[model samples]
Structure formats: structure tokens, C-alpha cells
Target chain A: MPKGVPERGSIPDDGLTTRQRRQQPVLAIHTGTGKGKSTAAFGMAMRAWNQGFDIGVFQFVKSAKWRVGEETALRALGDAHLASGIGGPVEWHKMGEGWSWIRKHGDDADHAEAAREGWAEIARRLASERHRFYLLDEFTYPLKWGWIEVSEVVEALRARPGNQHVVITGRDAPPELIAAADLVTEMTKIKHPMDAGRKGQRGIEW
Target chain B: MPKGVPERGSIPDDGLTTRQRRQQPVLAIHTGTGKGKSTAAFGMAMRAWNQGFDIGVFQFVKSAKWRVGEETALRALGDAHLASGIGGPVEWHKMGEGWSWIRKHGDDADHAEAAREGWAEIARRLASERHRFYLLDEFTYPLKWGWIEVSEVVEALRARPGNQHVVITGRDAPPELIAAADLVTEMTKIKHPMDAGRKGQRGIEW
Candidate 1:
């Protein structure tokens, strides 16, 4: 192994050294009509945080049902890093607020503008390499709802600066984004307790 | 809704009250060949931890190449909980030690015995409600290899005590476990950068 980089047993002749291959950016997405898509992306963020990578979590959802616990834990982790200088900094940004599954009140026009602004800010960050790991949680919804262009988002990710890794999580991801991704995983639902009248518990759901 | 529990719009008339339904335990599995199975389970563990649930992570594997970072972050979270009285306690146990992907060691018989013992221990804990959230990481291997009985594991999970939520992660899960699970998500791979000669990166992979 050159410079302690695992050769991965086989490598295509892409004219890039193993080190270069190791340093390449990762563009991935978690998509499907199932749960754990965003959870897995958050899980990757935890690993990235452990490795001292600057983390940026952008939530682009039409509604917020049960993600409070996740935010609290990640924020605590971020504070721990800031206090002890163990891990890198973490920044969490929500594109839209007050959109609820049970009670919806936010105006669509305002949310659309906010979503556009969020996408623009993410695009700027990608260009400047602001964060090593960018987690765009529930991002496909805006694209699905026609509030953001999937092509533009893909182009920005494809041209991201440095070794930044981007992971997007949502359902019904556009084919263009899927085709452009280096890795994509669809969380297919086989069964759910909600089908059996089991209500969401506070700890498990959030 | 009754007592602020979300009714979920549709609930089958299973004779259980909304409160009882809210108290029902969840049995879930994250399976398939794609990535994010373990990551999603870890993500759920973080959520469970945030909600003040005692977490127990049991790792059953034939090889351990990475995963050092995950253990570190979770342990730090555990320590913070004890120090600050926030979140919950965490117990992480690895069944097999010195088993490596690069250099495989340890006798098969020993590992099988250890896995059996580990399963037995989990069964005991589930019966006793030792932990509020049980994470059986990569536990399908032992069941797949017949070192542990899938049916017995399913029975234990189905008959688990209290409000414990159990999530198992691995590839090629047994059909019995799948049938017994309330939630199952198969991570289907759409694309991978490794196919294009991309080696694993430290901050992302670990």
C-alpha cells in the first residue's frame, strides 16, 4: 500500500494515483418510500464528526414531524467539539419552518423562496468548500415540489470544490440526480408498525 | 388527539387503546447488500439515546476493519450523559475480537461459540428489559451461519419485555426475522464510487 492507503484490491486505470482516488469526493443519496434515509445520512455525519470533518446539515423539508431528538444530540456533539477541540465544527440549517404534518400553516410562496435561498447558500458553500461533509436532509422534496431545480443542484454537487462529501436524503429523487450520484441507496419498506396501529413513540420515532 | 398522541390518521382496530399502541415495542431490521444498514441503526441509537433510553449495542461480526470512529463517538456521548445527566447510558459490546478483514484470525469454533453466547446474553437482556433500546449490529451473520437460531431470536424479540425497541442490522437477514419484524428497510444499491476505483476515505467510511 502506498502511504498507508488501501488499494481496494482492484482499481480501474483512471490515471489517478491511489492517494488521489482516496481523496476523491463522494456524492451519494438515500432515497425511497421508507424510513432511515435521513437517519443514515445523520449517522454518516456522526462518523464524519468523529473524524474531525466540518459538518453542515441542511434540512429542506416541507414538514417537520419528528426530528427534534436528532437535532438535540447533534447539537450536543457540536458543543462538545467546540468546548474540547476534539472534532470539527457543525452547522445545522433548516430551510423551512412551521410546516407540520398535523397542522400546516406556512405559506407556500414564502417556503419556496426560503428553499431557493437555502439551495443558493448550499451552492455557495460547496463552491467555497465551507464544510467537508454536507448533509442535505429531505432535500428531494423541494425538487419534487418544483421549488428547486434538480439539474442545478446536481451540477453544483458535481462541481463541488475540494474533497467535500455530499449526501442527500429524501424520497422520489429525480432520475437525473440519481444518475449523477456516485452512490445511491433506496430504503425500501417491507413492513411498518404504523400499519398495525402502533403509534410513534417519542424516543424511537424522533 | 387523545393525550397528545398523534393518531396517525389510520389505525387498524386491534383492540389496543391509543395509549397502549403508543407503548407497544418496535422490532425493526435494516438489511440488504447496500450500505447504511448499520449506519441507520446507529442513527436510531442516537435518537434513542437522546430520549433518555438506555442503549445497548451488541456487535456480532466475523471481521472488523473499520467502525472504530462510531464506537468513539457513541462512547463520548455515553460519558457526557453520565457527567451531565442528559441523554442516557450506553453499553457497547463486541462479540468477537482480533478478527480482521486484512488479516483474519481466531478459530471458527471459538467465534461460533462466542456468537452463541452473545445471542444468549441478548436473549436474557430482552427478557429482563436490561436496555430500553437494543441495537444488534451485524447480528444476522450468526443467524445466517446457523451459529444461532433465527426462529429463537425472532421469538425472543417478539416476546421481549416492556417498551424496548430493538433494531438489527446486517445483510441477507433470515426470512423468519423479516416476517416477525414490524419495520424492515432494504438498502438497495444504485451506484457506488468503488466501481470507478475510489478507495475508502477516512472521514466518511469510518
Candidate 2:
């Protein structure tokens, strides 16, 4: 076994060739208790965009006011794409706007409706092959909170059309989602600055 | 503690306002045995780029032939900055060339000089504040293999001038580096498709 590459036994004898495997859709989940789950998803989207993949970012964070720096850069990239054919198209949606937890925290009725609607829209898009690359940013929250159906989401992803690549990021990803994902990485906090009384900063946090 | 934010006890008696705290420089590390260590760092670079930070990415991986997608995308962004001034200036350096491990393995005499020269260059840049944001991608390898002095690197980082932010990514990060860092995240592999015989693919892996 080479440094990072696993042993031959790790290769489960899948019948597909390497080229065929390359063409397959990837379902990746970035979930854990540390940072960079969403950041890494955005990074992957940047790479996919460079590969001429239509990028669709659906941010489902709990806070509607939490507009991060990636949004600004990605939106700029989207504009640049529209103006000149440099990279692929980019679409960013703040899915938490309608039923934000910061606005209505304990009320499952309001938040659940928004979450289901968001998931329903994603399902429709998956079925129609709207985006070549999909980033469900902070999407695990809805699934974890029971606002969205895990089984239905998994089913839609399983049956998604075309070679669309989906990357979902958040903490506490459902076990079933993990099972369905092609790649799942847990961002463990080794050491954080906030431990030394550091609050979140503007550019880094947002 | 609200969801992700630490509790009140996590906030020490440090008497600095949030604005003042935001002005401080950050030293981050992304290290573990899983993927996305470099990807997440690139993602953070994009955000910093959006914030108009001069970006410098120095890749010190063993394999010189390995050109990832972030390189292309970031170079484009850098070019875009040069042409239209949308973002900040970006400099991407493949520091692993010349003395690549894939080219010359277990030959310390050939590789050690390049590694030391790379570290020296980075130290000079840190002292001069060459870039507002620096991504030292796969930097831990040299330290782990004793190609670069960990104590010297830490000293340079500590003595870095101005508000230069640094992010180093790789596996097997030194304890001294971790101790000196403001933020550190370990990418733990929960599940991977390569485990099921799916080899690395284009557009996703790159």
C-alpha cells in the first residue's frame, strides 16, 4: 500500500473501468463538529466550475443573516461567467431566508415548511438535471432536525439524472446519508482559537 | 452554547473588542489522513481573495506531476485580477518541483536543499509581509521528514510581520506547529468510495 492509496483489497472488484468510474456521479458529504465542511464544499465547487460544470449552491444554514465570503466570490464568478465565458455558470440560493431559526427557533412548523420546500426544489432540480455541480451547503441541518425526509432525499439523490455531482455540508449528517454518499469526511476539531476566547471574525466566519 | 458557538465560559477575560480582535493575524492548519485538506485551504483563499487579500499558494507536495483543479481556478482568478482587478493578486508556486519525491525518493542530499530553500523563501516573505494570505499547501511533509526545521518554521511564523494570515495543509502536522496555530482542523475519513474500489477521477479529484 502506498502512502494514502489503500491496498488492493480496498478495491471491491467493481466491474467498471477507471474511465467509466470517472464518468459516474459523485455523492460527497462533509459532516463533522469542526469547521471547513461548507468551505471545502465551496472549494470543490470552484474546481468543478473550472471543469465547466454548472454550479448551483443552495445554502440551508440556520441563520438567514449568515452570508459568508464564499457567497460574494461565487456571485462574482457567476457574474463573470455571464459576462464572459471563462468558467461555468453559478447559481446561489439562500434557502434559510424564509424560515430562519434565528427568527423562529423552537417553532418546527415554520422551519419545517421552509426546509421541505427547499428539499422539494432540490429534488425537482435533481430530477431535471438543472445543475452539473450541486452544493447543498449546511444541508445536513434540515435532515438532522427532521425538517426534511432523509430517505426521500437519499432516494432523489440515488435517482438523480445525468452526471450531476452533489456535495452536502453540515454537522450531524444522517447515518443513511453517510451510507449513500460516495465520499464522507468528518472535520474534527484538533484545536480552535475560540478556545483562547477568540470570537468569529468577519472575513473568516462570514 | 448556541448550536456551533462556544459557551460564555469559552470567552476568556481578554479585553479586546470584536473589531480589534478581527485585526489580528491567524495561523491555521488543515491536517489529517483524509481528503480536502488542500481543497478547504483553497476555499479559504477564495474568501480571502474576495476580501481583497493578496494571495500566495506554495504547494510542497511530494508529487510534482500532481496538478489539482484549484491551481487552474486560482490562476484564472489571479489573471482575472491582473486584467480586470475584480479580486486580489494571486501567486501560485509549485515549490515541489526540482526536488520532487516521486522523482528522487530517499535521497536526502538531492531533496534537502530544495526544501530548505523553499522554507527560506517563505520565511523572507513572512518577514516582508509579501502576501496578506498564504496557503502553504502540503507543508507538513518537509517537517515530518526532517527536510525543514520545525522550530525555525515556527519561529518565522511567530515573528511574521503585519497582518499576514497563513494556512498550512498536509498530513502528520508537527505538535509544535499545532501548538503555534490559531486554528487547526483534522480531516477524518468517515467513508470513502476509493474504499469500494473507485479510483480517483478527473473533475472531482483534480
Candidate 3:
């Protein structure tokens, strides 16, 4: 009704009241060839964390060795939550080499297996309502690379019970997942610092 | 050279080495019709805060009446930083009606003046290196509304000294601003809950 607000019913008929809609879980996907997909998801994670949502972070591509700043801050918040009982649980898992199973048997097949295992774990968590908010960082690659099937992932996500929110971030997300998601954002690159021969810097990239 | 990696020299010859590039200030613009532009900037601010960078957040469009989750978390971090000397200073300012000055003198001309004043304060901070990281949230709106001049903002940003990092977020960013920025990302909307008649939700929109 407002000048800037989108026209009424421009938001398609989802056949739910505002209250009913608020109760429904959200599946948000951030995909594009820009820099902030994961970062934006992490920001949402921060908001969810502050609201006392149990948060799970599953990193698919970032090396465990790479110390991301948001991870550290959020992990600290998690620790504080545990100590003070102010917030909910926070769990961070790296599906790359850092995963114990993959670490035990390192190889290409193991990497693919590890991705499957990671998906399985997430599905388990989703079924059990393990976390209210899940950040699947750089997850689209698994689907794109065929390490994980998009259809299966979509099925699991759709079947996820309760009000669990999931955010998947990466470039070139599979179309099925995009179709399945309730919210999808594509971070298109207009220009990049690397275009000027600049590398990622601390506190900016991480 | 690699499949995913940009080709050698694809990053233009800025004549800046890794160290030099790292030391150079960053002007990042996040603009698009999609969500997460401000959220991504806040994520970077969190990273900057964790890295002991003095952080300043200037809100241009968001109502001061609305309390954002990032502001709360960051202000808390700022307090901890002050008490424990672990991180750096964090200052949050609202240049909207919530501002005492603007509230005291409410008018269209005053609103325009307030925008100018906000820019002037930022310019002053830039000159003095008041903060290492600045999040100019919803900043592009003022420029778009002609409350602030594009050339002036670009000039101020370009003339900024030191390694101070600034992230400006808003939709429909002026072409001049994009040209001046070293990094720019347009958050294109693929799908949104609002498209399905859902309003902003807690821990997601805020």
C-alpha cells in the first residue's frame, strides 16, 4: 500500500495468513559469482544466533585451515551461550580434509564420500530438529560437482520438520534447489578488487 | 591458470604487490534489488571487529526505531573490546529521525541537511582515520534521492587515506559510485518469501 512497498498480491498467493507464514520454516539460498553469498548467510546466522536459535555451520569447500573471521566470532558467541545459557548451541563442521572420517581415509573417492556423509548428517539433523538455523556454506558446489544429488538434497530439505531454517551459499547453485528454495539471491559481480590485481585481505574477505 | 581461478594478469596491473594491495584501503559497494546487501556489510564489520579494527556504522535509511540484530551484537562486542582491550572501538550512529538533531528540526530541508551532515562527518572521519572499517548502511539511497551529490561522495571516497575499509549498501547505486568502487556486487533477486505474500521475519530480515 506504501509508495515504495511492492503492490499487494504481487507477493503471490501462498494461501497462508501472516501468522501462519511466520511459523513456517525458511529455505534461503544465496548464489552468484560475487563475494558476499556466504558472508550474507553468516550475517543471517548471527541474527538467528542472537535470537537464541541453535545454529549449525557446515563448511563444504573452505579449507579447515582457513580461519574465517565470522566462524571465530560466532564460535565465541557459541561458547558464551554455552557458558552463560544466554543463547543456543553452535556447532561448526568442515566437510573437507578436516573431517575425521575423510582424514582417516584421504582420497578423491573419500572426498566425494565425505560430501555424501556431510549431507547425510545434515539430513539427520534436519529430521531430528537438531538446529533451528543451519548454514550450509559453499554447499552448491557439491550438487554442481555431482558429489551430492540435487534432487535428494531438495527432498531432504522439503521433508525437514519443525521450523528449521536452512541457508545454502555458493555460486551456480543447481536449478532444482533454486526452485525448491523459498528465498534465493544471486550476488552478481559488477566489479571486483581482484580485477585490479588485488588479493583478498584480512577482515574483508575472511 | 586454473579452472576456477582467474587467469594470470586477469587481475589488471595495478602495480600493487600482495602486501601493498593488502595495505590499500577498500571501497566496496553492495547494491541490488535483492536482500543481504546490508547484511553482508555487517558480516564484514563483524570480521573487522574481530580483527581489532575500529568499526563505525552509519545508517542512512534504516529507521532508528528499528533495532537491528547486528548493531546489538556489535555494540556488545564494542563494550567487551573496551573493557578487555581485545578488539577495537565500535560506534553506531543514526542520521535519521532518531537523531536528536534531526528530531529537533524536522523538515525536508533539514532531512537533506542531515544527509549532508552525515556525509561531512564521514568525510571528517576518513580524513582523521577515525575507524578502520566503516559500514555505510543504506547509504546509496541518499545519493539516489539527490540528498547527497554523487561526485562529492565519490571524491570523498577516492581521496580517503590509509587502509580504512568502507562498505556501502543500497539498491540502485549510481553508476559513478560503482565506477569509483574497487569492489561491487549486485544482489539480484531470484526469488523471495515476500513474493509469496510474506513479510519480514525475525532472525531473518532484521
Candidate 4:
């Protein structure tokens, strides 16, 4: 046998490799017209927190009253915060009225500005290893529409602290991001409640 | 067999059965004489948060200066508040004066009362479904010691608003409480620095 020969079913023993501690945590988000993208991001956050990593989350589209599991669960995570819409959907109908929930319809520049500010907040948090995860909810749509600069986001990821994990989500992700991510998932829409003529189910889909 | 009967090995109809939704959310904390209990609790918190649910948590047993992931992560959560150490441990501890670490030398009643107050705060959150998850850190040991009333706890669980989850943790969980719980996990101790002649690892165990 050679010095580094391997058996058919088993390789020669090289002793158990010591676990390399994780470095440069993670920066990922799901984008595309699909469902469950946010769910996927939050799942990762949960896993990271279990390992004693800090986490932060921001939701662009949801209102304070539209409470869901992750938002509620995060309240217990001593340092986590979520700034979101206040009451109703922040969509095309509710353009900016100076309320956080307003969508600022058709105003690409305005939307882009808001997104930029959100990213800036995220960047500040990401600079600290004290908080390891930052989630930007519904971030890609603004980025895709030229409301936010994709290059700025790339820079943010590059500059993130060694132990930080960042996640962003929205429809229509830039191709450059897809090529650069450690993990990427696409939540394709097979069917949805609105399609079935049903409002969002409280405590379930919302 | 009757004609048109479903054949064996054929797939059963895959549809959700119409059962009453689990109105009482399950609360679980992975705590014991070992570490990682807080980390596990934080994981559940993150899971609940991503779903956009409202939640409340009270940190008992640990000091304000003894900041960790929960303290750091929840800072962004906005709604979260930390009322730090009540000057006790899950079990008896011996600490030198002027420090807040767990002490076997502290008065039992002081510890018990502090834990009771914590439970009351959790119960207050449970009264409204606005916060879907309520966490009481290091709660069970005090309960087991008769610091908090079992009847009151049972009543609180029964009175909890719909879909609210409550999590409590500590060493030596009572058998009666375990039997009543929707989910209970015992974190068995396998190894520890205390046994290995090393202090708890910073950021890993503490």
C-alpha cells in the first residue's frame, strides 16, 4: 500500500481533524418572486443564536400588529430589535405619508433612500462581533429597482465583522449577489393564499 | 375486501386534518446542571421572532454586567427588557461577597422570592396574546423548591391567551411539571470545565 492509500469502503486513518472554528460568519438573503424566503432566513438566525451568536432583524414590509413567531421570539433575545411597519401593508397603495409602513409607490429614489438607511443601520450592527446576525427583510426589491446600490451591499458584506451573519430577502435579486453567496435558496411560488381568494391567515402565513 | 377500497402501500390522502389548532404554544428550555441552556432558549426566541410574533422575556439569575447573546441580540427587539440577577443560582452556590455569580451561600427565601416575581412577570405577558412567547429564565428550580405555587402556574397556563408559548429553565425540574408539559427536555450533563479543572470558556460556556 502507498503511504496515503485508501481502502474501497474506508480511507486510511489520518486522525480526526480538529473542528475549524467558523470565520467571517455569513451574509445571505433570499430574493425572487416566491414564498418562504423570509422563513428560510429566520431559520438560519435561530440556528446561529443557539450557538451563542448575537442576532438582529429588520422587516421592511410588515407592520407592528402583524406579529409572527420570529418577531415574538426575538423579543426575548436580550439585544435584538425589529423596526417594521406600524399597522397595514406598506405596498403600492400606501405611498409615503411619513409613516414607516408607507410603501412610497413609484418613487424609486425615495424607496432607494429608505433602503440605504436600513442598510446603514445593518452595517453599524454588523461591524460589531457582539451581534452576529443581521436580517434585512424585503431588501432586494428596492435594490433590484435601483432604489439601493447593489455594490454598496457587496461592500457591506465584505466589511462585515469576522463573526457576523447577515441575511436579506426580497423578490428580484441581482445576479452578482447570486454568484457571491455562501448559500442561496429560491422560494418559488407554487400557490398562495391571495391567489386562492383568502386573506393572510393570522398566526400562520402572516 | 370491498370493491374500490384503498390498496395497501398506496399513499394516503395528504391533506391537513381539521383539528383545533394548538392554541397553547409549547414552551421549552434546555437547561440543567450544565451550560447552553440560555443559548437553547435564545434559539427558540429567534424562531418565534422570524415569524413576526410578539414576545416578552425576563432574565433572572444572571447579572446585568454579565452580558451575552440574549442581552446583545434583544437590544434591537425594542420591546425586550432585562432585569438582571436576583443574586442566586439554579442550585446552591458559594460565592465571595460583593459579586453576583451564583452562590450556594445565599438565603433560600431571597432566591425563591426573586424567582416567584419573575414567574409573575411571565404570567403577566401570558395574559395577552399580543406577546406570543414569554420566557422566564432559570424558573423551574425555584418552582421545584416551592418558591412558586404549582397551582398558580397551572392556572396561568390555563389562562394564557391563545397560541402563547411559555418557556422556563433550571436544573432539577419536577416530575409533576414535566408530566404536564407539552414538551420537556432534560439536558444531560456529559462533560464540564468544572470537572476538568478549567474555568468556563468565555463566549462558549459563560
Q: Give each prediction's root-mean-square deviation over alpha carbons.
A: 5.2, 4.5, 3.3, 14.2
Q: Flag regions of model 1 displaced more than 4 Å.
A: A1-10, A98-109, B1-10, B98-109
User: How far does residue B66 in candidate 3 sit from its true spot (Å)?
Assistant: 5.7
Please write out the lDDT profile of model 2 over residues B1-206, one tens digit for every residue: 11335533565667887677767889999999888888888888888887778998887865644445687677777777888787788887765454332354443445667778678888888998889999998899889999898999999999998889899999999999999999899998887777766766556777
Error of 1 at B81 (Å): 0.4
With candidate 1 superimposed using the best TM-score fit, by how many Å does residue B129's alpha carbon deviate from the native?
Answer: 1.1
Cα lDDT of all candidates, in order? 0.81, 0.79, 0.80, 0.49
Q: What does candidate 2's lDDT look like per residue over A1-206, in tens digits?
A: 11336434554566776678778899999998888888888888878877778998887865644445677677767766777787788887765555322354344447677778778888988999999899998888888888888999999999998899999999899999998999999999888777776766545555
- Evaluated at residue B189, the lDDT of candidate 2 is 86
Which residue runs does candidate 2 get wrong by more than 4 Å?
A1-12, A62-67, A98-109, B1-10, B62-67, B98-109
Highest DockQ: which candidate? Answer: 3
Predictions in order: chain A TM-score: 0.88, 0.87, 0.88, 0.68
For A1-206, candidate 1 gives per-residue lDDT tens digits of 01243335466777987787778888889999878998888888889889889999888865455666777778778888988887777887765563222155456567877788788888998999989999999889889999899889889988887899999999999999999988898998887777655777777787
CAPRI docking class of candidate 1: acceptable
Find the candidate with the highest lDDT and give its number. Answer: 1
Interface RMSD of 3: 3.4
Report the C-alpha lDDT of model 1 over B2-98, residue by residue, as the tens digit. Answer: 1243335566667887778777788899999888999888889889999899999888875444666677778878988998988999988776673
Compose the digit string of candidate 3's lDDT tens values, residues B43-72: 888788888999999988646533357776
Predicted complex 1: DockQ = 0.45
Cα misplacement distance, residue A193 of candidate 1 (Å): 0.9
> Model 2 chain B: which ten-residue window has the lowest total lDDT?
B99-108
